[model samples]
Target: MGNKPSFGETDLPCPQPRQFPMLLWLLLLLILPPGRDQSGVTPKAFLLLNPPWSTNFHKDEVTLTCRDSLSPAQGDIYWYYNENLLNKKSEEIQIHKTGYYKCKTQRSSLSDPVHVDFSFDKLILQAPHSVFEGDEVVLRCQAREEAKEKRFYRNEIQIQSNFTLQSVSMNNDKYHCTALVRGFWTWNKEISKHLMIQVQELFSPPMLIASPSSPTEGSPVTLKCETWLPPQRSHIQLQFCFFREDKALGKCWSSSPELKLPTVWSEDAESYWCQAESVTPPIRKRSLRSQLYVQRIPVSDVTLEIQPPEGQLTEGENLLLICSVAKGTGTVTFSWHREGTVRSLGRKTQRSLSAVLQILTVKESDAGRYYCAADNIHGPILSKLIRVTLRIPVSRPVFTLTSPRMQAMVGDVVELHCESQRGSPPILYRFYHENVTLGSSSVPSGRAVFKFSLTADHSGNYSCEADNSLGVQRSDRVILSVTVPVSHPLFTFSPAVPQAVAGDVLELRCEAQRGSPPILYWFYYKNVTLGSREAPFGGGASFNLTLMAEHSGNFSCGADNGLGIQHSEMVILSIIGPPSNKTTLITEGVTAGLLSILGLAVTAALVCHFRTQRNSERLSTTGTPSYSPREFKEPSRTSNTNPQEPLDPVEPQPVYNNVNPGDSDLVYSEIWSTQHTNENSANSPRKHWEDKEPTVIYSDLKKAYPDDSTEQASIVDSDLEDAVENYENVPCVLSALDR
Candidate 1:
């Protein structure tokens, strides 16, 4: 013990290897910067109470230590009470006053608040100042002196002496403790005051904020996560994240408080929110959901379309106008206008890209240029201009027919004119006869004319039609009549024989081939009119004339109708006297031999006696025989016969009938006798011959033979005396010889 060194000179033991490392770490913390840890995260500042008591009597003392992730030597501590700063700079503080207390470090955030209650009461119940969910809690009863047999109760129920809770949370249940104390002479019971505990939130629920609440399409947008931590837990690191509906927008967990979007679209309008969470403690919170809506683009590329496509408008038709835009949305307004109109023709408001306006029964006044406009809160856009025109249809036409004469004759020209009251230009006219197309003509304006020569086939109904491509119009029908003229006529005389007696009857007839009704026929003899007759219906006409001496000249007939007159060839006629019977001689074998000769001689002597007596009378009367009837007049009928032809027959007695030899020659005979009385030179034999003069018979003969020429040779005799004298020169000798 004497050899031991003085107290100040004693040696100390060296530290262990594990303990040396811990000491080295503490040294490094004291020299490093404040707040930030090894991971570059700033830790929150906090305060801790010494002895860990909640409530204390008046004038009681408590110690508060401002703590952070950094060592105390690295940063100074700050203190606050009731949101007021304290002047102290030490890491530890002691106070006897009761109030809300908080603390922070120079390089850290503020800590959570703590309530310290300083009461004047004798007995009180004690518990932790700041309580959180899932934390261990302890309850105690205290008084001015020591107590025994203490008991505690929650709300009104008794609890064990340990007075402990596992995973405690906030509550308003009253907690009290009762204990027995030794007072003056007897043991007294003391009861502590009731207390209630409040639980603090880890961090306020997160709030999401959007930068441009109402955004347009194709523009930028920003989102932020807003939250706050308790002052006591400010050093806790929190991570941020954003989501749309239930899907994450970008990184699931990010340290940034704000999330950025390059562009937003119409499809991006949906529910959105953000989340904030502590990194170590796993305290997570979500913000309230927000809806983001994007506006649509403005109207553009306006256009107008027509319904017919061809743009052809006709009278009494419907017109349609369609206005539209290539890209637009929401409510839209459309307007239609004409070129010269002050007001819009039509207007429509709807949620579609196109609109239509219909005009029923289009007319001529609707023709003009047109356009359309569209708007959707933006300026109006116009479409290209279009023009419309109208056309008119044809109207009923008028047809007329004109001719040169009142009564249309064959070969007359007829004119047809067609016209319409209302129609477009370049009209076509067609003329029809009896519903058959005659001809067609085209004219630019006014009426059309077509002329055609009249014919028998053109005597029917006529109509005309006009067309201008819209429709065809026809006119009422007109009737036509045609007339024909008469042709040459034929004349004929009927008797079937060349010769006829003075009392014979004859017929003359005239006819035409083709003529109108009521034809008049005239009969002529010797170039003089005999009589006239008319055929009512259009055939031949005939006249009857008794044969007379004046009717022996040439005969002809003519036919006359309204059109013209036509004449026929002339025909010769003859009138002759009846035949007489007397004693005659027969030659050709002389069959009546003796009787014929004796009769002939007797007849000759009588003829000689009369001739001698007549000759003596002629000598007494200047030697010329004048054979004349005292009151005889010349016959009015003149013979048209050959003047060289003798009045007597070449045969002793020739026949006057049966004379048709395919030739036109004819024969006839006439006889006349007269008696005279004279007193000078009277002779008996001359008187017998004069008596034999016997009614001097005269015969005119015109003969035609079977072998005669076919040429029609006419013989005309003007003198009646020459024919009688030629007959007297022949015959007295032949007469006496035959007797």
Candidate 2:
């Protein structure tokens, strides 16, 4: 070194500017350690400080050395101060100036710039120009002579004298010192300029790295914990650890810087990081977290399930078809198909294991076998088949009643048939009579029949019901009439006189107690037909005629409906001429009294008969009748119109015959009629009430022929074995017969 220029002078030699500075940067790349200062360009060269302090006395000399990775003998060294060139060629030099200095080599880039401070003041703060992080450092505050007292500060804060930094971190801190020195005889105080300490990094932070960053499932992976240390500190032992989402990937701590994974799965996709620590210094560092993702497995084992469970689904109901996969990952496509259809019923694409397709309203056409398929990146997988059947609701049931005869007579066995036109069976059919259930029957696919024995109560309205689970349907009502056979009738005449003369008027009545409505009655004389009258509303019929000579004979009456005709016992009738004038004149005096007595007696007898018939009817209706099931014989009709007979329906209510009080030859009689249900007859009632046999009561008032004046009245009761008692009162008779 010839002579070093002062830092304040800008004029210096320029060594003929060459392109080597640019070429040097391009040729020799400086690979920096990890976590090296990121704020500036990387430096290929560095400076070594002698005495280690940047601030020193002006008279003190400091040695500087230029160090680089290149060989010292292969390149000459150049030096700069405050960006100005200096005349220096050796790799080492001595300086006593305060300025920023840098160096370069012929084959290497420029080193990082450093600052030096030379002070002429009495007080100075001394610290190293280049200090590494985590290094123990000592600071000194000095004066030209011994100080009586001294004080120091760090970062503008007062600190104790002789302060030492133990394991100091890489921080830029301003330091200064204040010293009290004895100058001549008086004491004086001096303060040094603030110096900022610069700390160099010893090693770089660790970085986490994965070879083949994106790995497939079941594939191997390699993980490395990367870091760098200074060449001087390269011999320091370091330990590394690898982690995934806070869980250790290998041994918690290992000397090896790498971790190997033989196989990875989808669950292994997570945040990963690495840690590096020095064994001697116990310095630890961690890398920033990185994300690792593993590919997924393929879709397989597809299946389809129907909502509402079984195949017993009804029409007009919502249907749900679910498609699922036993194992799959990533985006999946699901499709539902019917066995006989060309297009899929539904399709869905999503990141899920199952998908659903709903049909708002199912119909009969939707009944079929169904299946589903699922796919990912791999091929499609099919599910097992499922059959769905739609049940049809039962249509309005058709209800019908059948019997062996044209009419549903009592004791006849009839069948009630109920069927549904369109529906699924096993259908249940219930038979109803007058809105009340009689019995029930069930069939798999067609009509169902319930056998019922007809009774008087079973004659009203009839209906049937058909039901499946889906819904219930009912049929319209059918009307049935239970026809009953006519019983033997009672024949009688009006007037209480003993006999009837040729000139007297006569009335005859006939009635059948237990027969159905619309009964026909025939009046006969000596086996010859008189005429017929119809009692369309039931109870009885009557005929009126004048007693003539030809009418005197045995009189009888017959009653008939459609079932059968019954005839009454014969009554003897003998007609004579009118009374003699002398006798008539003799009885005429007491005629008023006799007429009153006869009227009272007749009224009493008629009332008693009516009450008895009413009682018998009430008992019959309340009790079950005994029945002998059989068919009744049909009646024959004969036509012989008589001029004396009234062809029209003479009366609908109870008949009352009028009598002439003046006619002493006229006779009146009250008739009581009753019916018997034969035990062997098919139309008989099933059970008799109180176990009582059938009986008929007859009471009559008669008048002898005018030749004799005797008047007779009698009562008779006849019991029929094993017969139901059904009775009715005959019409009252009040007729005047002239003698």
Candidate 3:
């Protein structure tokens, strides 16, 4: 304010003229932030040449460097050729190649203009000429200059870089070159070369094969897998896999070219293929498909059976059998067999769907177990077993008689029978006796009968039997008997010459020597029965009858044994009457007379015989003396009164010499006595002849009385002697009658 004196007038402080505001303004300005320059820190600039490098000149080195405006310092550098990466050091890189190139620094700065001029005699990329699809190949970049390091790159990627004397590898392509020093410049000459690679095909995979080119249906088959490779590559290790359609069969790794599977069935057959792969890299495939065919085997069911249903079979009957098959195809073989035997009855083959067998006519041996089998290629198959059996029946029989006495006499008969029980049909029966077969007959059902007439020879035991297919049976024994009858009888009589007198009896007898039983007999004379009697045992019968005129003629007898009557032979009998009455008187009076007469006659006869004998003796001895005078007297009777009569009387009577002297004497005495009586009578009376013989009569009277009496007595004695003789002859007469 001191200076403030001037304050009012303008130059006085020219105001310190706005010094008044300058203070404020200068202070404000000092407190405000500093202002910055608009342009950045000195910008780093670089240049990249196109197609950066070439190796056209011999022993040429390509260098590429990056220059920066900043101080020279070490930094990471990158190089590129086209879009590929390159190796670098210190913001620089070295290369020997023909390629596009570029570079950068690690300081976040751009390099100076990049130069790609590097001359090489040639550019080369190391890669395989041929490789599999997935094989690995490498490309390397190198320089001809011996002292220069080499870099490797591919497709803009950085690879390692070797020292000047080392080699490097580059698997991918892209590159650039650079110098190790900073800011080293190269001309902008660039050249590019491309690497070439090729890929080749792998070995085709293996093929699969099957055996039995074509197989029958249902038959077994085999399959095989095989592969082929180049002769040089055949030893290469490879893995093989086999497939059928989508299915994997199996895997095999071996030097051999083939694989095999045995006995494949139908289901295993299909299209088949194979593959081969190297152990290291790419896998390769090849395949072959083949159509497969499978064939079918024949099949069948066989059976055996019997006919006529069920039942036991008979021997000699017909039998039937059959064999058959149900299902089969193609040719089938059939055979028949018996169980437990290795042999077959028969065999046959047929293409037909069905088969059969038949058998007929059976025997006992035909029965057995039977079976059948069928086959094609498959096998022989067996059927169920069947069984058979057999049977038989019986025959006929015969009968005979054995008992009740073999021989029968009169009325008798025999009985016989035959039978057959067990036979099929028509049985014959026969009967026999005494080894003679009688007759035969047929019996359809059972039995037969026979009757025989009895005979004497039928006497023996007989047997019968029957037979058929079954056997024979015999019958018991049988027998027979017979009978006979009686015949006529005979009779005879004895003394049949004349009549049988009184006191005599005639005998008549009847006999039957041959007859059967109790015989009744009767004796008859002239049809009258003397007596009725029975000779029970059949001997002769006798009848006695006093001789009578009425009982005398035709005597006979009859015999009967109750069977029939038999008459005996006829006989004749004669009867005579006793001596007449007159004869009786002459012979003898009743009783005493007859006796006396007989005695007297005997005495007289004796006296006469003695006198005769005496006389004869006296004549010889006493000479004529003492003869009875009556004996010497001779004829006293008349005799016609003549000399001749005397002479006739006088004639000596001749004596019978055969007569005894006693007999002669008796005779002479009788005659002399009669003569004396006659002489006396003749003299006394010459009256009647009857009277004239008075003396004779007187002599005759004596002679007559005595002679008559004697005669009677002799006759009586004779009769008695005859009766005794008759009595003795009676037995003889009876015996003759019996004969």
Best by lDDT: 2
lDDT of each: 0.70, 0.72, 0.49
Q: Which candidate is the best by TM-score?
A: 2
Query: On a 0 to 100 scale, what is the lDDT of residue 589 in model 3?
Result: 57
lDDT of 3 at 540: 77
| Cα-based lDDT at residue 650, candidate 3 | 37
Give the clash count for model 1.
19
Stronger candidate by lDDT (1 vs 3): 1
**Tens digit per residue, CA lDDT, model 1, 1-739:** 0121121211222443434443443344456465665334455566778756768888889998877655463456767776667898888889888876766676765665667778786577888766654345788788777678889898889988868765553345678888887677877798887776645555666778788998876678999887766556667788998999889988878999899998776668898988877775555678888999878777788888876765686767898999999987656789999899999999998777899999788776787888999987767889999887766666788998989988777899989999997777789999999889999999988999999998766778999999989888999998886665666778777864566777777888788887666888888887799899998888998899888776677888888776677888887777887544312334333667766767655654544455456557767988775542211233343343766754323222211112233354543333322222232336433464556753444444455233544421211131344223322222233444433
Instruction: Please provide, for model 3 over 184-276, each residue's C-alpha lDDT reduced to its tens digit, 9 standing for 90 to 100.
Output: 353222223443232233343445566676665434445554443322233446666656677766455543344555444344456766555
Which runs of model 3 end up more than 4 angstroms from their true locations?
A: 1-121, 130-138, 142-192, 209-234, 250-256, 280-291, 295-739
Which window of ten consecutive residues has the lowest lDDT sum in model 2? Answer: 713-722
lDDT of 3: 0.49
Model 1 lowest lDDT segment of ten: 1-10
